[model samples]
Target: MVEVRPLPSADSPLVEAVDLAKHFDVSPPWLTRVLERQPRTLLKAVDGVSFAVPRGRTFSLVGESGCGKSTVARLAVGLYTPTAGRLVFDGTDLAGLNSRAAMAPVRRRLQMIFQDPFASLNPRWRVRDIVAEPIRAHGLLSETRAIDRRVGELLELVRLTAADGQKYPHEFSGGQRQRISIARALASNPEFLVCDEPTSALDVSVQAQILNLMKDLQRELGLTYLFISHDLAVVYHISDYVGVMYLGRLVEWGEARSLFRKPQHPYTRMLLDAIPDLEMTGRRRIPVRGEVPSPMNPPSGCHFYPRCPFANERCRAEVPLSITLPHGGEVRCHAVEEGRLTEAAVRQALGRGASAP
Candidate 1:
C-alpha cells in the first residue's frame, strides 16, 4: 500500500512541474535516414513547460489541439518519461520511478481519467470488473465480499446504482460509462486525478453533469486535478488556475480569474477572445489570426511572434523571458516583459482594461 504523508501544509503546491519537456523522434528508422542522407527529426511535444496546482485546486491546461496539453498530462502520471526537467507530486520526485511495475504504487495515488469513455472502457468487461480492477491490483481488499462492497460504494459515490456494476460496459450510455471510469479511478482512493478532456465527447447537458460530478468528488475527496481541455468556457468554469501552452512552452499561467480578467500573453488573450460570451454585455472580442505553426519546425525568437499583433524586432529576434507577476505566476511574452504595451494599447487590442496585467 502507498503511504501518503500528510500534505506538508495547506499553502504548498500539490504538484510542481518545472521545465518539463518531451521530444519525440518522429524520423524514419536510423538506416532509412542514413540511406536518405537526412538527419533524424525531433518533434517537441512539450518543451520547457512549468506550472503548479495546489491541493484541492484545479489547474487546467488549455490551448489549441496538439499544443502538448495531453503530453503534459501523460508525463505527470508516469505514463511517459520526460526528456528533461521535473514533475514533483506532493513533494515526491515523479521522475525517479525505475520501472512500470514500480510505478504501480504511484498509479494508485495518481489516477488518470482518460478521454473517450467508450474507447477507455473494455467492452468485454463487466462494470464490477472494470471498477474492481484497481482495487484488486493494489490488493486493497483480500475477500470477495469486501471487494464487492467497495465497488458498490464507488459506484454510488459517482451517483451510479450499485446494481449497475453487474452489467456489461456496452449496456451503459456514454455518460454512464464515464461514471464507471470515475469509479475505477477512485477505487484506489487516489488524491490526484489527471483528467484529459473527459467531457469533450459528451453532449452539452452531459458535459455539465460530468463536470459537476467531478467538482463534487473533488470537494468530498480533497482531490487535486490537472484538467486538460481545448474548451475555454469549460476550463474557466472548473479551473482555479489556468496555463496557456503554445507550440510546446507555457506562455502564461496564473489564477484563472486573474488571467482571464487580464491576459498578459497575446496568445492567451487570443484564446479568450475566441470564446463568444452570451452574457458579457459590452466586451469586444478579438479574432485569432493565422494557424498554429508546426512543432517540427516552430518559428524562433518567440513562438507567438508570428501572429502576435504587438510583435516588434526584438520579439522576432529573441525569446522573451518570463515576467513575474506581483500576485502569482508569470507570463512569457516580449511586450509584457519589456513594459511596452500601454494601457491604451491593451484596451485598443482587447477593447478592455485588464484586472491583472
Candidate 2:
C-alpha cells in the first residue's frame, strides 16, 4: 500500500511548466525532399505552454484531440523530452537529472496512468506481478513474501481482494483493470501522478467510480495530479484549475469554477457552449465551428483565427500575448484583451442561434 505523507504547503508549485514546447520533424524522406526541393517541416505539437500544479491539487489540461494534451502529459512525466523550455518538478529541473541512477528517486515519486487500461497492463502478467513490478523494480523490498504482502495491501487499498491478485489482466472488468493500474502507480508511493485520460475508456458509470476512487485516494494520500483530458465535463468535475489549449497553445486558463462560470476567451466560451445541459434549459448550444488546422501549417497569428467568431484583420495579423484577467486567470485573445468580446456581447451574438435562457 502507498504510505501517506505530510504534503508540502500550497504556497509553492509541485510541478511547473515554463514555456514548454515539443516539436516533431515530419518532413519528407531525404530523396523526396531533394526531388521536391522541400525544406524540413516541423510539427509544433506543444508550443510555449506554461502552467503549475500546486502541491496536493489537481491541475488539468482540456482541449480538442491533437491539441497536444497527451503530449503535455507525457512531457510532465519525462516520457518525452522538450525541444525547448523547462519542466521543474518539486524544485528540481528534470533536464538536469540525466542518468537513471540520478533519476531513480525522482522516478519513484512520479508515476503515469496511461489512457487505455486495456493496453497499459500486460495481458500475460498476473495481477500480482503487475502490481508488484514497480516495488520490485525500485527495490523497495527484498524478500518475495514481503513484496507479496505489499502487493496484497495495495490491491486491498484499491478495494480489490488479496485473492484477486491471482487473476490475470483479462479476467478483470475495465474498471477493475483501472484499479489495478492505480494500484501499480501507488506501488512506489508516488507524490505526483500524470493521468492521461485515466477514466476515458470506461462506461459513464464506471468513469464516475474511477473518478471518485481517484479523488478519495488524493484526499487520503495527499497525492498531486496533472490530469489531461478532452472531456470538459470530466475536467469540470475533477480539476481545481484548468488550461484550455488550441493548436498547441494555451488559449485560456484559470480556476475551474471561474473559467466555467465566466469563460473569457472565444475558444473557451465555444467549448463551454458545447456542454449539454440535461435539464433542458433554454441555454443555447453553440456547435464548435471549423476543424483544428494542421500544426505544421498553422495560422501565422492566433491559431484559432480561422474559427474564431470575433476574428478580425488584427487578429489574423498579430499574435495575442497572454494577458491577465481582472479576476485571476490568463487569456490569449485579441478580442478579450481589447474589451471587444464582453460577456453580454458574446451572449447576444451566440444567442442568435441559441434559445432564450
Candidate 3:
C-alpha cells in the first residue's frame, strides 16, 4: 500500500525538489548506433535542480527556450517523472506513489496550467463542459445542476460571466480563452498550480491582465504557484522567488527583488541586461554573445564557460557548486564563489555606481 504521510505544518514548503534530474535517451536504434560507431545520446533536460515553493507564494523559473523550465513544470504536476532525485509535495514523496490510484489524492491538490490556451481547450466542447471536466473527474460535484453552478462560479472567478459558459472556446479571444483555461484548472480546487508560460501567448496588455487576475486569485484562495517564463519583466512582476536556469541547470536563484537588484551569476546578469532599460538609466548593458550550447553534448566543467567573460582555467576544468549568498539565495559560479565577480566589480564594469533596477 502507498504510505499516507502526515500533513505538513503551515511553515512547511508546499513543494520541494531535491537534486531533480530528467534525462531523455535520444539515441538512434541499437543497430544504427553500432554501425555508425556512435554512443547513446542523453539529453539532460533538468540536471540536479533543487528548489522549494513556500505556501501561498510565487516561485518563478526563468530561462531561455530549451533551458528546462517547462520540463520542471511538467515534473511538478507529474506529467513527466524524474530519472533521478525526489519531488516532495507537501509531506508526500511523489517518487514513491507510482500508481495512479496512489497519486489521485495528491493530484487533486496540484494542477497544471499549460501554455497556448488555444490548443489546450477542446474546440467542440462548450466553455461550461471544459470547466466542469475537472470537477466531475475529481468527483467534486455529482449532480449536473451542482456542477453547472460550480462551473459558473469558476468562470466568474476568472472575470468571465456565467452566460459565457454556453459559448464554445472558439468564441473567445486569446486572453479570454486563457481565462477559461484558468477557470478549468481551478475547478479541482488545487492548492498548487504549475503555470508553464501561461502568459507567453497573449499580448503585453493582455498578459498584464491575466497576471493580475492570477495574483488576485492567489491572494483570495491562498494558492502557491510554480510559474515558468522566459520574460524577465513578467517574472519580476509576478514572482516572490526567482530561479535563473541555463542548459538544464539553475545558475542562480533567490528572493526576486534581491536577484534582480544584484544578479550574482554572469549568465543571470546577461539575461537581465537583455531587458530594455525603459527608464534610460544609462547603465551599460552587456551584449549577449553566442547561442546556447547543445544540451546533448554540454561543455565540460561549467556549461557556461564558453560564453562567460570571466571564465578561468578552473571554470573550464571543474563544475562550480552552489554558494549561498549573504543577502539570500544561491549561485553556481566560480567567479562569484571566488569573489572575482563581486557586486562592486559588476557595477564598475557596467560603467555606473548606481544599483541595478
Candidate 4:
C-alpha cells in the first residue's frame, strides 16, 4: 500500500483553489440547436481541481496543451469566475468580491504575466508607458517624476537599461520584451504572480536567463507564484510543488523532486517517459499512447484511462478520489490506490517493450 501524509491546514496556504471548475457553453445558438434537435453542450475546461500554494513558493501546473492549465491561471487571477468552487487568496474569498471596486485590493496583490510577450505589450506604446501603466493604475504615485523613476528601476531590476524604456516593444528581442512584461507585473508590487508559460516563447538560453531572474526576484521580494507550463523540464527546474493535469482534472501533485523521482499516476509517468534522452542512445522509451479524448464528450470515470496501459474496469467506471501519499503529495489513480501499481512496477513496465525514441 502507498504511504500517506497529512496535507497542510486550510488556513496556511497563501492561495488555495478548492474544487475549482469552469465550463464553457459551446453549444449552437438557441434557434440552431432547436432546428438540429441538439442538446446544450458544455466544455469542461476545468473540473474539480484543487491545490494550495504556500507563501514564497512556486506551485506549477504542467500538462499537455488543452489540459486546462491556462484556464486555472485565469481563474486564480479572477479573469474567469468558477462555474463551481472558489478561490481563496490570503484568506479572502474572491467570489465574494463581486465588483471591480471590491476586487481592487486583491487585484493589486495579484497580477499576471501573459504567455505571449510580443502580443501582451502594446506595439504602439513606449516601454516606459507600458511599465508605468500598472504603477499609475494602482495609484502608487501621482508625481510624474516618481512614476518615471519607478519605471526606470523596474527596467533595471529586469536587467534592462533605463534608456531602453524610450523605445517601443517592437524594437526589442523576444527575451527583452518578456523582461518588460516581468517589469510591468512587478510595477504593482504584487505579492503573488500568475505566470502563464512566461518563458516558453523564448530561446533556450534566454529561457535560462529569465528563469534565473525570476528565482532571484522571488528570493529578494519573497513572492509567491502560480506558474503554468507544458514543459516538464521547466517545471522541474523552477517549481517547489508540481501538479499534473489531464482533461481539466489534476491526476497527480506533489513536491517537484518527489513527483519526478516517483510519479504515482500512470499519466504522470507517461508524461515523464515522453521526455527525450540527452545522449540519443538506443534507450528504451515508454510510449504514452492514445490521443486525448474530447472534453465536450469526455469518457466516463477517469479521463486518462483510455491511454493508461494498466487501466481496468474500475478505472472506466468510477472516478478515483485524490489519495495523499507519504510524501504529502496527492494522486488520483485507481492503480495506485489498489496497490496494483507502484514505483518499482512503473520502472519495470518502462523497461519492458520500451521503444527507441
Best by TM-score: 2
Model 3 regions lying over 4 Å from their true place: 1-10, 343-357
Q: Per-prediction TM-score, please?
A: 0.94, 0.96, 0.94, 0.94
lDDT (Cα, tens digit) per residue for candidate 1, span 1-357 = 335656534488889898899999999998988899989899999999888888888999999977899999999998899999999987777898777786777777999998899999999999999999999999889899999999999999999999999999989888988999999999999889999999999999999999999999988778899999999999999999999999998999999999889888888878887888789675666679899999999988998898988899998899777778877879998898778777778766655556533
Candidate 1 scores a C-alpha RMSD against the true structure in Å of: 2.8
Q: Which residue segments of model 4 deviate by more than 4 Å?
A: 1-11, 279-282, 343-357
* Model 4: number of backbone collisions: 1
Locate the minimum summed-lDDT window of 10 residues in model 4: 1-10
**lDDT of all predictions:** 0.89, 0.91, 0.91, 0.90
Residue 231 error for model 4, in Å? 0.7
Q: Against the hidden true structure, what lDDT does model 2 obtain?
A: 0.91
**Per-residue lDDT for 1-357 in model 2, tens only?**
446576667778899999999999999999999999999999999999988899999999999988999999998988888999999998888877888898898889999998899999999999999999999999999899999999999999899999999999999999999999999999999999999999989999999999999999999888999999989999999999999999999999999999999998999988988889878876667898889888789997899998888889999999899999888889999998889986567767675633454
Question: What are the clash counts of all predictions, listed in order?
Answer: 0, 0, 0, 1
